[model samples]
Target: MSDFGLGVSGLAAMFALMILRMPVGMAMLAVGYFGIVIMNGDRSANALLVTEAFSATANYSLTVIPLFILMGNIASATGFSRRLYEAAFAWVGGLRGGLASASIVGCAAFSAVSGSSVATAVTIGKVALPEMKRFGYSDALATGSIAAGGTLGFLIPPSTGFVLYAILTEESIGQLFMAGILPGLLLTALFMITVTLVTLRNPEAGPRGAAVSWPERMRAVLRAAPLLAIILTSIGGIYFGVFTPVEAAGIGAGLIILMALVMGKLPWGVLTDAVLDTVRTTAMLYLIIIGASVLNPFLALTQVPATLGEGLTSLGLGPYGVLLAIVVIYLLLGMFMDGLAMLVVTIPIFFPIMTGLGFDPIWFGVVAVILIEMGMITPPVGLNVFVVKSVAKDVPMSTIFRGVLPFWFAMAACLLLIVVFPQIAVMIPQAMFR
Candidate 1:
């Protein structure tokens, strides 16, 4: 069979394994290794496997993964996430559909510290779900807001999605982080607008809570100040070139731990659990990275990316048209596959096409992350929807899915805006570098 055909078969096999309940990393790894052995030789495959595994695990830059994960896990343990929710609630809870809006705001804030969508959804959902339910918020709006807001974790600064993208694409992590900031905030605003429209259309869906006193609002803000400071210091430091991504992650993790300790919020057991969770998450990420490392070379050897890029370019679709097609493909894949799995599998094929079309890598990274975020809340496989479901157990899965539909369109609008005006994704990164 032709090399390109073999590559296609390898991908098919990987998906089949995934469907059979094999882990994503292992599925990719198994296919990649066997594909290499068939295409090259056993010696080459063995050497590649050993080298990629060791290098991916030992790389200093990868340390950022664990540190950032630790920061997020500790932030959750220390009740920082709850405080953020309270602070946002204090300001917005009086508005129509305000509790739901506050959940979005709080999720955005928590996302700064927690890079995982699941983490953001679970943590914020725990805090906001009960409050929204108590205040007579509809199940759909309440659950939808949390699920959609959780997606911000992937688009906001300190994002694991950006970190993984940077590692894969060889783009600067800091630049990607900066590029995400404006788009992230923009999407957050769009989500808030969606909530307002929803509440307006059906006043019974969301009843406003009593207005918080100015003094209470001030106190809530003050209480959440330290968490906000950590976000600004870590993410802000990266933008200002005051710290590298790794250094920022370390500092953020250390500060979070310190704050938790000082507040006596992080007991020994909680600290230990945080550390273990970080280790597990970091390991999982490394496995995926290593799998991608192996799969990339196999795909390269097969010349699939080059062939795909050339085929698309030859279609006379123009660059924008080709990009739109790619975006559509991602949206479809996202409905069935895990986001990171989709990224690791497809980027090798698409990144070259994007760059060859003269698109900026950093901007593309932001766009790609946003697409992945959409998948997190999109249909049957929407992981964030499930996470929200887990928290709002009383709510039906169908209800949660129904809730995210409007926000899903809001995301689509955000994506469209960024596509038409690429500056939304690149302007901050450019200024930061300049």
Candidate 2:
């Protein structure tokens, strides 16, 4: 069989294993190992496996993953996430669909700390859902806000999506982190606007809550200020070149821990659990990275990317046309595949094509992550929807999916805007790097 044929078969086998409930990392590893052994030799495959696993685990840069995860876990354990929600609610809860809008804002804030969509959804959902419910917020709007807002976790800074993208593509993690800031804020605003339009269409869908006094609003902001300050200091330090990404992660994690301790929030039990959660999440991420590392070399040996790139180039679809096609493919895949799985599997194939077409890698990373975020809320396998469902168990799955539709379009619009004005994604990175 041709190298291309073998590569295609390897992908098929990997997907089959995944369908049969194999862990993504193991599936990729199994297929990649055997493919390499067939094309190269057992000695080569054995060496590759050992070196790749050790290199992936021991890379100093990867320490950012556990540190950032620890920061997020500690934030959640200390109840800092709830304070963010309260602050947003205090400011926005009296307006039309205010609770829903507040959920979006709160999710965005929490996402700055917790880079996992499910974490953002579960953490903010617990706080916002009950309040929205108390205020007679429609289940669809209430749940939809939480589900859609949770996706900001992947787009905002301190994003694991961007971190993983950086690791895979050899792009600057700092640049990718900067690239996401403007687009992330833009998407957050668009989601809030969706909430407004939905409430406007059906006033009963989201009723206004009692207004907060200016003093109360100030107090709420004060209460949430420390967490926001941590986000800005950490992310901003990276953008300004004051710290490397790893240093920023360390500083952020350390500060969060210090603040928790100072506030008497970091009891021994909570601290231990947060560290354990960080270890578990980090291990999962490293496994996937190591798997991708193995699979990437196998794909390289098969020359599938070269063949695919040349084939697409021959079709005479210009860069944007091919780019659009790839985006559509990601959208379709998003309906079924896990977002991280989609990234690990496809970036090996698509990243080269994207860069070859002269698209900026930082911009593409931002765009790709946005597409992944959309998938998190897309139907069928919309992970965030199920997360919100877990939190709002009484709400039907269908209702939660229904609620996220408008925000889904809002995301699409955000994607289109970034495409048209690539500067929306790249401008910050360029300015910072320049």
Candidate 3:
């Protein structure tokens, strides 16, 4: 078979394996290994696999993944996440749809630490779902808000999505992190507006809570100050060019540990559990990176990326027209595949086309992340929706899907704004890097 034929077959097999419930990394590894053996030889395939695995595990920027994850896991174990929610609630819990709005705010704050969407959804849903239920918030509104809000973890600073995009496209991690700031905040605001409109249309969906006293609100902020400080130091340091991503992640992790210990929140057992969780999450991400490293080379040997780029260019679709096509492809793939899978598999092909079309890599990273975030709340396999279902077991999955529909629209609006105003994604990054 021609190299292009081999590449096409490999893609088919990889997707089929993933659909059959094989782990994503393992499927990519299997396909890439065999494809290389077929196209080259067994020795070449083995050597490529070993070298790529080592490269992925040893990459300096990749170290940021584990440290940031450890920060989030420790924070979750030590009740810091609860304080974040409490602070958000103190400020906004009395407004109409206040609890739901508080949930979105809490998610944004937590996303500054945790980069995984599922973790953010699970953590916040556990806290906010029951409270909203007790306060007579409709199941749809309560569950929907948490599911939609959790997706912020993928867009905000320290996001794994941006990290992987950086690795795949050879872009700057610090710049991607900075670029995500405005778009992330934009989506968060749009989500809050969705909640407001929902409550406005059906007042019974989300009723107001008792007002919080100013002193009480101030106290709540004081309680959550440790995390706020950590966020500012790590992300702010990056923005000022005072620290690289690796340095910022390490500093953030150290401060969280020191603060937890000082506050007596780091019990021996809790620390152990947090470390184990971080290892599991980090290992999974590293495996995916390694798989991409191996698979990407095989795709290169077959000239798939170049061919796809030429095919895209040949369609007479101007830059924006091609951009729309790529967006649709990502949205469709996201319905069935995992977000990280979509990133590693597609970026190698789509990224070149985008940059060749004169699009800014940093801005495109923000736009791509937003599109994937929308899929996380899209129906059927929307990962966050299922997460909310697991938390609110009594609430039907269909209801959770229905609840996220508004927020999904909010995400689309955010995507539109970023498309029309690329500076929203690039301004901070440009100011910092220039």
Candidate 1 lDDT at 429 equals 86
Deviation from native of the Cα of residue 413 in model 3, angstroms: 0.5
lDDT of 3 by residue, 78-180 (tens): 9999999999999999999999999999999999998878889999889999889888999999999999999999999899999999998889999999998
> What TM-score, to 2 decimals, does candidate 1 have?
0.99
Task: List lDDT for all candidates, in order.
Answer: 0.92, 0.92, 0.93
lDDT of 3: 0.93
List the candidates' TM-scores in order.
0.99, 0.99, 0.99
Point out where model 3 deviates above 4 Å. none
Error of 3 at 81 (Å): 1.0
Q: Which 10-residue window of candidate 3 scores lowest in summed lDDT?
A: 374-383
Best by lDDT: 3
- Candidate 2 wrong stretches, greater than 4 Å: none
Q: Give per-residue CA lDDT, model 1, range 1-434, as digits (tens).
A: 99999998999999999989888899999999999999989999999999998987777777788898899899888788899999999999999999999999999999899888889999999999999999999999999999999999999988989888988888888898889899999999999999999999999999998899999999999999999999999998998889899999999999999888888999899999999998888888888999999999999999989999999999999999999889999999999999999888888889999999999999889888989999998888999998998898899999999999999999999999999999999998889888
